[model samples]
Target chain A: MKPLYVIKIGGNVIDNSENLYHFLKDFTALDGYKILVHGGGKIATQISEQLGIEAKLVDGRRITDIETLRVVTMVYAGLINKNIVAQLQRFGTNAIGLTGADGNFIKAVKRPVKTIDYGFVGDLNNSSVNANNISNLMEAGFTPVFCALTHDGDGQMLNTNADTIASALAVALAKHYDTTLIYCFEKKGVLKDINDEDSLIREINPLRYEELKKEHIIHSGMLPKLDNAFTAIACGVKAVVIGKSDELGKLGNNEPFGTRLSKSNIS
Target chain B: MKPLYVIKIGGNVIDNSENLYHFLKDFTALDGYKILVHGGGKIATQISEQLGIEAKLVDGRRITDIETLRVVTMVYAGLINKNIVAQLQRFGTNAIGLTGADGNFIKAVKRPVKTIDYGFVGDLNNSSVNANNISNLMEAGFTPVFCALTHDGDGQMLNTNADTIASALAVALAKHYDTTLIYCFEKKGVLKDINDEDSLIREINPLRYEELKKEHIIHSGMLPKLDNAFTAIACGVKAVVIGKSDELGKLGNNEPFGTRLSKSNIS
Candidate 1:
């Protein structure tokens, strides 16, 4: 199987133009088939506020009301996604910007009405991710840039998490290609000391992950990210790395770059 | 060669929910490869007013400054495009929403500064539209829903005229398929009397078009539209129709549904 790179970049990287361009340059320089999944940054919130829409959140997850959905769709799918695709095109890469709604690429179910309804938010199903369309596009020499939006297959576009999208896409594409999922952000990697830059963990296994959680070292935002990374590894993705966006090539080449997540301690 | 339907709907139809859905049903019922080009409606102007951005216009055409460009991109690509695609999906038609930036499908050069500058507005070039990708996608069974946003191929998304996009795409796709370009607006057809619906002209040829212009019957907005239609017909689109959108199938079958533009009056 040919190698495919499925990289996810968070809002922190996207919000900073310098970081985004630097990361895009590195991303364009990489070899092999690639797909980019991106999140809506603070800009969405800023726009929402400007539009007089109050964002509601619970347990760190946004409640995607109708107005919020429109704002995110505008910012993420419109401004951010197109800008990235255009820039990549300028860099000589034929990039296609997409939401999961495009080509029925990803069909998600609106999160069930539970204790806290996430409104228009969607939870991806097992067969939701359509890898064949993406593989065909890549074979035809186009890189797909995806925004954090999906469809319910029944005429509804839903707000989705980019990390989950990256993992789901990696799992789906793993059937056709040797897929490596990378989560890139401002951080170098999972840090041992939250404030210390030099405390970057070289690699981690299932056991170490649990230990870190038990010791409260990986708290707050990094927890869910790491959790998503390990989930990707377990889903047959060839490799998973959480790292700085600019160092993606080094991470892919197995150099000392990011915190590589492994299913077991064998590696 | 398989027949391909490249349909364009005006902002009037799109702004009305019932009309848009009715039009989509008619669109999806037609049997063949298809692409939909849409115009951003009054909602853009409404949003711009709410956002407090002054819309600059010279002789009725918008001058797309950076802020105006963002607004159009948001309204056209984000809200309107996705809604149309989602609705089509509900009707069991696999639809992919697109801006010209997606897949580098349509490349344009920024309209030059002549007497007045149309900031961020683009002029389509001969080599601008990438029809091969659209053909590949249609062959794969996805109907592309195109927004009026195009790219300069140099990291800038430019506001483009949707009617122009429709004509350009029709001309480009004419090479691979027997393309039928349909321009759907609120009117029944190009009427002999503007206020009389029964005065619909069943057919138009280059000679009659010139006569219409000479008589002052076709003036203002209809002028550019007819000019573009004639250009498309000259460029080898198998047929061109300007009509009510709900009558697409009848138009396809030549059942006197719309004003059919012909290269010569012989037919």
Candidate 2:
């Protein structure tokens, strides 16, 4: 067995704590075999308002100012990151919260998009994941928790989206320990339709995904998730799945659940 | 006049919703800002214990196992981040939660500590911060809340502490918009005697701090906080102040708040 799994979660799963708790229980049961990454854009926006601080975005990417970045670090790293680690510990699993800012486990460059000022948003260009560090944690029987934030060579907290984060992280871990990628969110699977809950897309291919996206059948957010799935596959990840977080272990099996995404060249 | 303030919060002060609620109330009253950075560590350790996870740490660092990481991502970046942001929004603060993994804002390099495997922990090395993201957010009147977890180019979560995070972020923002670094925590101030609260070392210079440290008057954790504060000053940060979270804006006025650190070369 590869003994490693890469999981990415979105804001919806986070809002559902009971589901999250149960998911944690299940996750720990597979101890020393998984790395968890998450996103918190919606939450950060909410907190910014509370502080009477407005949130700024240029070209769809968050503009991380001083006060906003402060709330982000405090909420994501301090409160949220620790909360997940503590809950896992409570369930007899050792977990540590981390960001890309530490130990250079991951390296990113600033995204210089045309016309739009992405600002602190980082583009996935370089990474230097140390397997020794990950192996040591696994050897010590611990899990590493992560949020969607990165530090540039300059002293700034760059913004990254969950799908992009998941894809990048999956590539790192996949190459590190021959792992599979599981991207979890609100929907059990990616739906072909944006409005119809029953139109759950059973499976998808990179080409077919493009067609759906081009046709506007699937909305914008899911397109990024799908794109990430393909990126993971291209970067040598064993496989990629999009679904609800609680069903990872069960779905990641040979007869996996959720929406499976494969490279057109593969299947 | 840039209308920005970087408030760095500690995990100790925001362990619960009630504590955070009050903190948000006061934070909202302050002038409009663009960023907020937060920290949370103790709760993660606490919950890890409740779950029967061993919570392994070698040389003050936790191993990044899969299970632990998952719980951490869910709790910190996902759950806690959103919860706090949502609470702030409820308090009328428009806050958004962010993790380092989301944006490659804070990039790092792996610490090459000989013989010791600090799994997933990155050294504070990167300085390429896109203050434009923050500035844009500020201009848009949005608060960008950030957590410490960042994604490498390859997308792995690096373990980062909040102190350096605050300092680095402060430097980024201050340089971007010429702002202040407000570090808030439970401690009244940096103390010469851990046992004697009144022995608060009102202030200290780098040379004198080194002497006090050699005399064994400083704790290991405090060493890093002070070091980071100094780092910010050197990096062009206007000021750094430590105070309680509830009274974040009151520091530098009359309150006996937390310690303030500056560059030794300044004098």
Candidate 3:
């Protein structure tokens, strides 16, 4: 079997029809192995506002009250998952839509409550993810499209950050299939300076990352992404790359399109 | 091997301080249950509003975007789950907060992509909840609080409805152990009319429920709850009930304080 390529996409791509369509087209053109994990946070907020409901965020994370969780489930899993599956099918990508709760593929633990107790958020450390389902889907010639929400051990669903979900998935698939994990986002790659688009960090090591974090050189969002990338590498993933969505196919061909994180810098 | 009780909580329970404190007081008293599935919609919306993000809903569901999903996950599974766990612990109920993605339980299938797809939402059709996790926690005198998010066959995490997650869990647990799924909400029972709060329907059969759905009598949010009730029944769940959350302890003692859904209408 060809080496599987695991890709993590953000929720921004959910409504960006042209970008999604283009990415799917490129994704389908080159075929070896693939899985897509995406996020859908913006769309949910739109709906919440219409309903006169307020959204809360703590430290860059949305607080999942009861109604928000339900709304997101309906959109992320039922609607978005199916929607992506349909789009992939349109381009003959042989796609299958899924959430993390199915077949126990992606697992999580509830995040410890903060000062103002939210409802049900989770920590990546508290969860476990299984990739067998992805293997099964790939064996059946189907590309699995995943949403970010998984089951904690206690017979309930918990919302997970998409970046963390992708990293965990990459670790699972890497150990299972000896594949590469690629995370695509709005930016082309990790940059040293937010303002300087050309200051992309081509390679990242743990020591430098920690120094950068402490010095406030890396942006807040990049902190978690880097952590997840480190985790994927530590968990025996072959490689981790932070790049743009449209150029993911180039990643599989060993193109240095983004910041690369390897085992030495992680575990 | 005592029968497991799977409780499904509503988001409204956490809206206000008084309500939250009261709910914690009551739920903590009934902490001997095997699992707890919680909801969190209001929190996500609050954050979205603050961030200048508009909330969107389709077919009565919230659409999740990357940003919002992250916030909610951190809130629901991270913050809220912990709060419930901590409250239960304060009442001498050894509790462990968890999300559905833990232990590869409660997985979901993502919706295929299409026009106006629901973002980050999940379908509960595909799930493999780890009943042993809940059972073990119970055996160890720990209450495992479950958040509403299940895994699909792939590595992605998708959002799940609390009721749906609870129902699917009950079904999954029933195959191994006698499981009772309880859905707690503000209403005393399933009402015949939305306006007539007193017109409570104590019970409903699948056929009758379907007729109500077909005739558009059951109405919006109630639709999925009803579907979950029937699914639980069909999947061998010992019992299902819809009622107020404050009566959990009474219900725990098998006092039957809620609107019970049984196979037979009345003995």
Runs in model 2 lying further than 4 Å from the true structure: A59-61, A128-132, A193-199, A205-221, A252-255, A263-267, B1-267
Residue-level lDDT of model 3, residues B99-210, one tens digit each, is 5554344556676678768777777663456565445435544455666655453535567777777777788778776777888888777777777767777767776677
> What TM-scores do the predictions have?
0.94, 0.49, 0.49
Relative to the true structure, how large is the alpha-carbon lDDT of every model?
0.86, 0.64, 0.67
Q: Model 1 Cα displacement at A174 (Å)?
A: 0.9
Per-residue C-alpha lDDT of model 2 across residues A158-214, encoded as one tens digit per residue: 556656766676676665676767777777787766566577776777777777778
Candidate 2: true contacts recovered, fraction: 0.02
Off by over 4 Å in 3: A57-61, A125-127, A153-155, A205-220, A252-254, A264-267, B1-267
Per-residue lDDT of model 1, residues B101-178, tens digit only: 888889999999988898998889789999998787677667888999999888899989898898899999999998
Ordered by lDDT, highest first, the candidates read 1, 3, 2
> By the TM-score metric, which is better: model 1 or model 2?
1
Count of residue pairs whose backbone atoms collide, per candidate: 0, 141, 124
Q: DockQ for the candidate 1 complex?
A: 0.71
- Global CA lDDT of candidate 1, please? 0.86
Predicted candidate 2 versus true structure: per-residue lDDT over B1-267, tens digit per residue: 464668877676568656677777777666657467777656666545644567777878567565565446545664455555655555555565655543335556555668776666655654635465545434543465776665443435566666666667777777566566878777667777776767777666678678878998876888777777777777787667766676654642455456666553332
Worst 10 residues of 1 chain B by lDDT: B246-255
